[model samples]
Target: MSVEVNNETDYEVDLHDVQKLADSITEAMFIHPETEVSIVFIDEDAMSELHVEWMDLEGPTDVMSFPMDELRPGSETAPSESGILGDIVICPTIAEAQAKAGGHAVHDEILLLTTHGMLHLMGFDHEEPEEKAEMFTLQRRLLEGYTGRPAPKETVE
Candidate 1:
């Protein structure tokens, strides 16, 4: 498996941690060695345009995923052999905003969005309650592994 991370933000993120998380996210999805994924950190303006074009949302969102099923990372694959998982674009500015809203650290929020994007590439969605539960559960599990920390405490209201 191959992973690429490109940062376009002013805030400094832990490159090693992000790289490990990207690898873990790909492994969590059971990707083969032929799989490739990219993580790009962007500013609010660039992120907002992507959100508008892809999901038709009104403004910048935390993360956006672009799946390229035919391009694996690192090695050039024969057109038929590549399993391009996709690209993940994250906005640290938005993540910081959400960290405050969600009562979590900015790093934690960024981790959440990274895993969320990976899940989307793995055919997971949160359009329904049940789907949301399963996806979120998997996301949490993957995150736990990525961070070497306990899973977040889940509460039912």
Candidate 2:
């Protein structure tokens, strides 16, 4: 899988570490090796604009996903269909505040947001109670092994 990370903001993010974690998550989720995914980091103004334009929300959000091909996770024996997975837009400023409030490192918060955005790219949503349960469960499971945090809380974008 090709995990492309672009930091468009002024904040100092570990792009290399973010890419590594994104690649690992995509691999663990069984995304096709040929599929391409982009992770973009933006500032509050940009995020606010996108939030209003795309989601019609009022404020800047943590993360937003724009799925290109609607790809799903594949099995070990069968790779997922090859296509552009999607673009995950993250706001570092918002994430930093969320991390501070959640008592976790900002990087871990970004990882959680990234994973959550990826799951959205894979057609996951928390609009309903059941959907929220399933998506959050999977998200926590995916992060716990890496962040050593047993329970990861949910945040909206």
Candidate 3:
């Protein structure tokens, strides 16, 4: 998979680590090897603008996903087709705050947000109780598999 990570914020982020996480996620999901996805880190202002424009919300959120080809996870026997998966936008400032609140490293929070955004790109939703449980469970599993450590508790609502 082609995972492109772009940092547009002033904060320093481990771009390589984010790319690796994205790769691991796609691999675990059985996405095509040639599939492409972009992960962008933007400032709070940019995130707020996106929040209003896309989601019609008032303030900046932690992450936002804009799916392209609307890909879905595939079975091992049949991986997803090669195409543009989607773009994941993240705000490091918000992530830092959330990290402090959760008592974890900011990088961990960013990774969690990225995982959540990628799942959204792959047609995952958490609006319902069952959907939230399934998505969060898969996200925790994926994160733990990649980091080789237990993922932080899910606090997203």
Candidate 4:
């Protein structure tokens, strides 16, 4: 898998750890080894602009995903086809605030957002009750599997 990380914000984040997490997620999801994904960390202002432009939302959000070649998770016996997975844009400023409110480390929240974005890239969504449950459950499982720690509980929106 080709997981590229670009930090365009002034906030300090461990790019290598983000890359590792992305790699781990792709591997666990049985995505093709040649699949490509980009994770970009941007400032709050840029995030807000994207939020309004892409989602029609008002403020900066934790993360947003722009899938290139739509792909889905595959079984180990039949991995997903090689393609461009998507782009994940994260706002560390917003993530830090959410982390403080949730009583978790900022890095952990960032990782959780990364997992959420990755799931979205793989055609997962949380619009309905059942969809939300399934997506959040999978998100928590993936994070716990990668970190070997209990994932923070996600609240219903």
lDDT of each: 0.75, 0.87, 0.94, 0.92
List candidate 3 stretches off by more than 4 Å.
Answer: none
Residue lDDT tens for model 4, 12-106 = 99999999999999999999999999999999899999999999999988899999999899889999999999999999998888888899898
* Per-residue error (Å), model 1, residue 122: 1.0
Superposed model 4: Cα runs more than 4 Å off: 155-157
Q: C-alpha displacement of 55 in model 4, angstroms? A: 0.9
Give the TM-score (vs. native) of candidate 2. 0.94
Deviation in angstroms for 151 in model 4? 0.7
Residue range 34-84, candidate 3, lDDT tens digits: 999999999999999999999899998999999999989987999999899
Q: Write the per-residue lDDT of candidate 1 for residues 1-157, one digit (tens) a residue.
A: 6788889888787666877888876655556766778889999999888888888887888888787773322322322244778888989988888777767788887888888887887677788999989988888899898788864432111
If ranked by lDDT, best first, what sequence of candidates would result?
Answer: 3, 4, 2, 1
Better of 3 and 4 by lDDT: 3
How do these models rank on TM-score, best leading?
3, 4, 2, 1
Taking the tens digit of each residue's C-alpha lDDT, what string does model 2 give over 1-157? Answer: 8989999989988888778777877788888888999999999999999999998999999999999999998889887899999999999999999988888788888888988998999899999999998988888887776667664466653
TM-score of 4: 0.97
Tell me, by TM-score, which candidate is best. 3
Model 1: how large is the Cα RMSD against the reference? 5.1
Task: Give the runs in model 1 whose Cα sits over 4 Å from its true position.
Answer: 70-82, 151-157
Candidate 4: residue 50 lDDT (0-100) = 97
Work out the TM-score per prediction. 0.84, 0.94, 0.98, 0.97
